[model samples]
Target: MKRKGLRHILLPLLTAVMMLVVSACGSSSNAGTNGATGSGSGTEAASGASQEPASQTASGGTGNGEPVKVVWWHSMGGELGKVAAQLVQDFNASQSEIQVEEVYQGSYDESLNKMKASMDSKSGPSLIQVYEIGSRYMIDSGAITPVQQFIDAEGYDVSSLEPNIAGYYTFDGKQYSMPFNTSNPILYYNKTLFKEAGLDPENPPKTFQEIKDAALAINKTGKTGASFAIYGWFMEQFFANQGKDYVNNGNGRSGLATESMLNSEAGVKTLTWWKDLVDSKAAINLGRKTDDTKKAFLAGQIGMTLDSTASLRGIVDGAGTNFEVGTAFLPKADAADKGGVIIGGASLWILNNKPEEEQKAAWEFIKFLAKPETQAYWHINTGYFPITTKAYEDQRVIDNMAKYPQFKTAVDQLHATELTTATQGAVMGVFPEARQLAETAIEEAFGGKDPKAALDTAAQAITDKIATYNKTVNP
Candidate 1:
């Protein structure tokens, strides 16, 4: 080579470097630009050890390179959690281009807290499953990207997704997260209890008064009447069924927090009904402390309940053969019923701090999950209603519903629902905290304070919280 190049290769000198490099070219470590590391992951190598291969990316619908690895955080506890874990494995096995890892934290709030901890350290999973109410925290924290943009860039067909499914994720007409595991509250009446109470086994309470009367009638049979848990969700659904919105800005789908409107007519009416039940000793106020009431229902100690469709699997599993768990649509408070209940399940959100290539890979897993067949599989395995129209029409969903008809109860409510702002959902800041406040408000109302006054106080507290959170979130 050049004399100057040779001068730099001299041993322990600049001239010696050329000779060393030339001789070492034949060595295995010199095969790649950075030592051609064998792509080992999960542990960093010793100092000067070559880095592994670059992270993979999804090729969208094209059957190109290896599937990307996407980490997911979920809280689909109990049997469904196992099913979701298996679904991830199945998807990873189904495609060579994408691998999904599902991690289960405990309950909904626990999962959110975990994600928040991740945010605090500037490290978080690529995908997070957040309930509808977590929108303010996720969006304001700037942790999640607007998923519709990712779908558009990747050319994934989103037209198949129902607008109603996407409706809850919209903020000022922009969609942040797509749909997953959406559900509405429904009445789970005990057939044997109903029969013993002289009520028709095939029929259930058609209105709030009817439920109260059923509770009173069933109470005579020595069974505690209706056993409602998750008082907030049940009450929210109860309000929606009566055609009243809970949160403002059209339940936060329109824009930032608007007004706390839960103290209105529908709200008071629903709480009044609950109060009446408590006063007449027709029902018991069960908080979120434990599933004691759930155990009571399964053990035939309680007659009816209002819980999520997500509970369907757990309730069935827990019931064993104690008594048949019969499902029905929620009752209306008004004489003229509006429609079905609002959506209440978690949706998967993509983190924005990821590298561009890794982001696309995560998007691949999301698109795979949105497929009709995949959605149907998820819905059948977990009692969540499929968020897509095609999923509802899928043959697998059809067959599964026949076997477990209760799976279709929430789906059926969708059809019966009237188009109203109430059914969309709520978005009060610190809504989780607000849920506790509402519970306390319910307790106060049950203690004989006018239902309207109790809700008004609760709404004022919620409004004050909204102001406080807005400052913390925006400042």
Candidate 2:
């Protein structure tokens, strides 16, 4: 699973941060927003004894020669970190031309912050894993090489990748990064609760009205019908579900985003629906943390909740005979809404500052990760669906699919999505801060403020932040 952190550090602080980084000697780790845990000791063990110099080789070596050393910085920790470490071990065992040292650089925020601090120095890793929202900042940083260059040079057929997943990383007709772990949100319902409430367990709610009705029925059973986390990510998903852009400039795909459309008709409607559910006691406000809602669902306190597919493994195991878990596509704002979800999770980016040979070696590791067999292992072990379409055909994936049929809902939802700007998701340098503002709006609405008024205030704040971001980046 993934996590969010305060990553919108101003440029002026880099000098001080860089100095501190140079003197810093210990590893740090933090839990992610996606329900994954990490240990500082595990981070130290994953990264190894000490950091390596950037220019370890005088020349790019290949095929039995001195191997090219490629350093990889990542945010995955705990069990996910172990899986990542195993993959690196497998890759190193598979080839002698490249050696990859996997480093666990805390959370997504810490990893990106370190990257920024190490930009002008040689302490940065050759390849880094950055979360989905960091795409805009990564591009604007101009310190990394676009994976498209390697793709074109090697004539790599990207057709094997899931289109919707790849669509998120593509900007200005170029693929900036190679998608690694990919996930989408889905509605997880308690099957036993549905049966108890006389709702059809097989036929889950698909629209706002249907969910509200289901929630009411489930509430009649003396349990909360739903407890949707007041997450900013879900707010964005609702806009996409209604075929509405969260920002202008084609959801920031066509060009730099200059405004926030969180106050659009779709946004107001979505918020009002959610508010109505809370007011009617059909659902409860669970604040901004998804973890709380997940716990509530597993404990049978809530009938349904919204969360990433990355949370499937833990949710299933946590339920463990207490209740049956049923998964469905995220509900649409209206029955006729045409858009779908945006992909979550991080992607792999190669640093331009690295030696060309090291970059090439890093590409090899990326290619290995994208292979069907590897992806299947990743999917089964980490709960993140594969980015490669062929991974679904692998026997392991097939077996795992049967074991947990609920997982297929996320896959179906992803494939069913239309590749539109809104569904592809919005991109902005100020996205992290914007999400916080969006969450604040949700809290205000739940606090009895008018939904439209709350959204308008948040949207204006995001617009001002966007303008400020544009000026600083483009100045």
Candidate 3:
């Protein structure tokens, strides 16, 4: 459900924008013009604050004994934004050598675009949060300093971090960023509706055929069976669930991906099954927004739906006093499918243009955020599971899990996932645009176009974009 804004801009235009932004950085009036929009009360200091140059110090402190300042740009909004702001407040209060100012940029796409436009300027943040799909682009941009350098220099023990979550950010045996918020898709169903439809409430559908059968049964009860949003992420997850790669070159882990495998047999099977459900009146094709489908499910208009684990808190609260909400692992294309879910959400990256002291300070803040206590608070407050496994042992997290057993399903599903290239996720510089193309393909298939034909066209378009991106980065 991440909102990716704007289409892909060529690298030439991006370079020109960077030059313009850097030239404008000399103006004092434009110091913090690129700061946060009003999203959190705790981030008042980050909105239009003047930028001051820092002097080198042995302990990452300013020349006048002031704390080193670190600016963080993020895309978390609403309740999540509040939680992020609270984290920043806690970190700033807990330390004296470093101070953090958080700015809530727009969605993931907007934040990444802003970073591209400002990376060469003084207005760019020392630390920024980018979505999972932006990993390849960020790595290729040559504007980031890999967090692995800090881990190695400080001898930090990373064994506590969830491997499956960290795997997405790791490249060439090196960790590029610190995983902040991680989630996976899950099946949410109304237990009351399942009972009314005479389906087993506890035994939710485990495979595509079973889901179809359950949906047909629910529809026979004069209610809609399900409504799945036409999300491209789900399509990627389905490929992983079937132990299939979305792109070649080891899911783009070993090397740059030259093509997309979106039209493979796995892809055709998944879309055909989904389109069949809609055609047979077993499911509704809710457009591109998962929000619309969430509303329908909460209103008891649909029996089951698919959504990220991050939505568990909001969904459960919305369904309160109405019906019991049952959570299950994401359905697979076949009963024997051995693949599992890929992690969603975003991670924190350190920009290379910042001074060494500021980068070190940003690393300190990142370490504080990864602590078990902090992760537990984040997990309970927002439905995102903790990236650190030790967070599960915290009393608060334990109690929260016991109270809302649905949350445990996500953790269990993550632990059950098999670590492989497919599950680690595909990487490409043009992933944002690729997702939009995938969504278009889904819409076309729903409009009566053959699933394979639609996927082939979309896959080719993604391949072309990948080639263009590769040339831009390599040339």
Candidate 4:
């Protein structure tokens, strides 16, 4: 959808062109202000040991000469981390022309910060995996070439890519990055606990009221009830599920976002319901730590939890013998609401400062990653939905989904979701900041503050941030 707003159209053109000019003159990390509205300070902590593979020679290639080296930085860890490493190993073994070195760069927020720092010194990696929230900032950074340019130049057929998954990284009808590991939020319940509580294990809650009722019943049976992370992403998902915009200008997809709509009636209703659930002990306050909540559910202490489908493999494996992990769509705010959840995952982008050979090699690596067979392997091993439509037809994927039906929930939910502005998810440049503010509001409500007052406070703060960001980026 094209935004009617002048700023949305002009700003991107200005941002992209101006950023390129700045790079031509003298590239600096602060060159273009990333065309992002906020103060540009990264809030996430960065810490981890960055490793370099022992072999310096290109391990895989067409055997013409030394393979081109492509440096890749990512944020995956644990079992998912293992799978990512294996993919890199396989990719290296597949060809004799290009070798990719995968580096663990802490969490999403941290990696972004690190990437920016690297760009400032003109020492960034050949390719970097950035989360969906950083899409706008990445575009403005002028540090990477848009994946669309590669597609157009190579005439690569990307019709096989899932529209919803591809939609999140698209702006102005152009795809900025390649969707690699993708996921959506889902309801994960402990089937063993459900049966013990006299609830039908097969029939999971489909609405907020049903969730509350189920939680109450489970609690009455001496179980811990439903609990989830105090994640800002969940707030965005709730608003989308109700077909409500989280910000102005078509959730910032059409134009530059200037304000937050998180204080609207639907927003209040959702926050209030969340606060009441916690207040009544139907939902456990697991704080902002995702691992803590996952551990709680895996230990069978909590009967239900909401998390990304990316967590499915870990949860199922962790919950062994303790409980049967059941999956379902995230409950709607109201039974009458007609909306769906948004996709959540990171994508790959090739840096612009790299050599042409490295750039082409990076593109080759990206193409390999998107192949149906490779994506199928990734989906089955990591519980992330495959990006290509053909990946589902792979025998491995078919067998995996049949063996563990929980993994199918995300694919089913994605197929059922109605494509709309809300489900396209927010594209605001200051979205990360807005999400942090929403999380603060959630914490305040859980701390006994009035839901309306809390959201209003956050909404106003978000408005101020958006205005500042707009001015800073476009002024």
Candidate 5:
């Protein structure tokens, strides 16, 4: 049963403080301190010092020698990170002209910090694992040379690219980065638990109420019902389903002011549902749990979880998880509530240095990574949906999905998703900090603060953060 924690009581005030602390601790903005290169928000590939500025000779700083190392940095972790490492090794072995080096740069925000720092030093790597959230910041600083230029320069086909993905990485009608791993959240359920709950294993929750119902039913078996990683990701998807906004100012990009409208009734309703679940002991509170809710779910303690498709690989490999773990599109409040979820996972951002030859080589490797076979491998191994069309068409992908149909939920959801201000993704400077605010707001409700007041405070605090960020970034 979900039990509220002590932190929940002081959530509104405490959440704001925690966000400040976390952001101060690791928030990455390319706005380096007086060009000292203190931090960059992208991954860095530690390429060996094989080619020097003079050793490389190519037009436009391409540095086309006997194929110097193309260092690539990413924010991938777990199986996702492993798959990327494997790809790097495979690329290095495939040809002698280019060597792609991969490095694990921590989580998405940490990686962004590294990338921005590298840019500040004027010696950044050629590739970074960027996300849709910071695309505006990257474009505003010109930190990234548009991947499309490389695509055009390399004569790659751009028409096959998904228009939604094109919109995701675009600003002012131009593309900046190559879309890599793209995933949205899906409901992971235990079919065996469903049967125990007297619910149909083939049927899953269809609405928020249904979600709670399923949780309550599952809890009847003396197991905790539901678990989730981050509430903001789920919140974004919730708002998308309702056609609401988390913030205005075009999702905090364009350097515009963003009002935290998540304080609205819709948001409160969503949080109230979670609070009810917690109060009902049907949902597990993450702070009090010994094992993470997802981990618990894998271990049969949790009946359900809502996480990104990236969790699929781990879920598949989880020990003592014999129940048929199934996946479905995130249930909405109603059939009329049909908006799609915002995407997660990261993208590839080319750093601002290196010769044209190395950039071309990096582009080549990225394209290779985007190939159907490579994408298939990535999806099967990492559980993130392939960003390219060819990946889905590959026979290997087909075969893998045929073997495990649960993996297809993320892909199908991405294809069916619709783009709105709410679901298009975010690009504020202090996003990680903002997420803490949302989390704290819910913590308060579970703690005993009226859900409405908690959300109002969260919205205000987030608004204040937006203003602070704009002042910091714009001024």
Candidate 6:
């Protein structure tokens, strides 16, 4: 695909975030409590007990033999869940050979855990959405048929897939999974607060120093200054923007990552900068939870923050018409740095044990979800950057961009990022645990510990964790 426009940059950043989530498993057998609830308003129940079960597909269509029912387990809920349901409805209505039943499997971790249990019992869904961090473990588990296998066997035209986004999932010329919901981090600021503080509302901070300057001004107005969740994903972004790797072996793109490099000079510099910001009262210690910091932003308690682009809709709805919200590229550590941000969000994988017909039916549904029209609909409804290169040209997407100019800023920033290994993201087997350690290290730094000491402790801990994980998977 020809790379053009701000939309082009999303693929690389998207790949990075997907490469950071780790694997999950559960012992639960009950689907209802395993985070399987119905989509949105009608079926928000915990067990995800659907009104339309597999029987509907068996009885609904003709001439295509019995319509095959393909179960899709996903982690989306709330507003995003509504959009997912609509996509399934449209796909089901557009054809008769397949019927997709989307089961809400809680958060990414919860869904993967249930999926692992289901696989062990040989009753897993036809397709499962796994976060990027779990990619290494997923490949090691030998549970799913690589989407690349299907693509190659069917001679599928995957040219429509965004390269940087697709690149993250690709290893040894094989795309392991299909890119689905994708996003990047951005700096969100309250324009009204900026103006109140006599800072230029139009010019948001472009670097950490500028953020500190803006935060100091905003704090003088008696409002909380900038704040962010102590998230490993954002820290990964900070590292990527500095052209630094999160883990060894080409950020785990080239080979198995056995250790973390987050305690190096780059890591110390980034963490120390964050620590100084906190010490000067220019940034808030919003703790480790992302939701807490998001609330702080939406409640107008804080003037600026760094968060995923996915939060755009919620911030819009929560802040209402009383104040204007603005978004910019996540402020760089250095203004002249060539590094770019990484993308966050998950992707879809097809399971291996399903019957041939069932597998094909699942692929059909997956391909349908990748269409430009479908991507545009999803993008407009959920704030996730569309995965298809052409989706941006769709009228709906164009209209939405015009309506919310802040959304366009994300596209521009994404296009500005150059693709590189660091920006491609890290793929560690114990990435989830590693991320927690990173977050904990940041929290320690925020609490006034020496940044290098805190990071060194976390780095050493991850190295030990990786060694143990490698034994189990590689043993």
Q: Candidates' TM-scores? A: 0.81, 0.89, 0.89, 0.85, 0.82, 0.86
Residue-level lDDT of model 5, residues 249-360, one tens digit each, is: 7765444656777788678888888788888888878752212556677788888887666656556556334878888888786678857777765577765456666777
Candidate no. 2 TM-score: 0.89
Q: Which stretches of candidate 6 lie over 4 Å from their true place?
A: 1-64
Question: What digit string (tens of lDDT, one per residue) describes model 6 on residues 191-251?
Answer: 9999999999999989889999999999999988988777777788899888888899999
List the candidates ranked by TM-score, beginning with the highest.
2, 3, 6, 4, 5, 1
| Residue 236, model 6, lDDT | 87
By lDDT rank, best first, the candidates go 3, 2, 4, 6, 1, 5
TM-score of 1: 0.81
Alpha-carbon lDDT, every model: 0.66, 0.80, 0.80, 0.76, 0.65, 0.74
lDDT of 3 by residue, 73-115 (tens): 9987666677788888878777678889999886665677678
lDDT of 4 by residue, 31-65 (tens): 11221111111111111222222222223334578
- Ranking 4 against 6 by TM-score, winner: 6
- Model 4 has an lDDT value of 0.76
Off by over 4 Å in 2: 1-64
- lDDT: the better of candidates 1 and 2: 2
- TM-score, candidate 6, is 0.86
Superior by TM-score: candidate 1 or candidate 4:
4
TM-score of 4: 0.85
lDDT value, candidate 3, whole model = 0.80
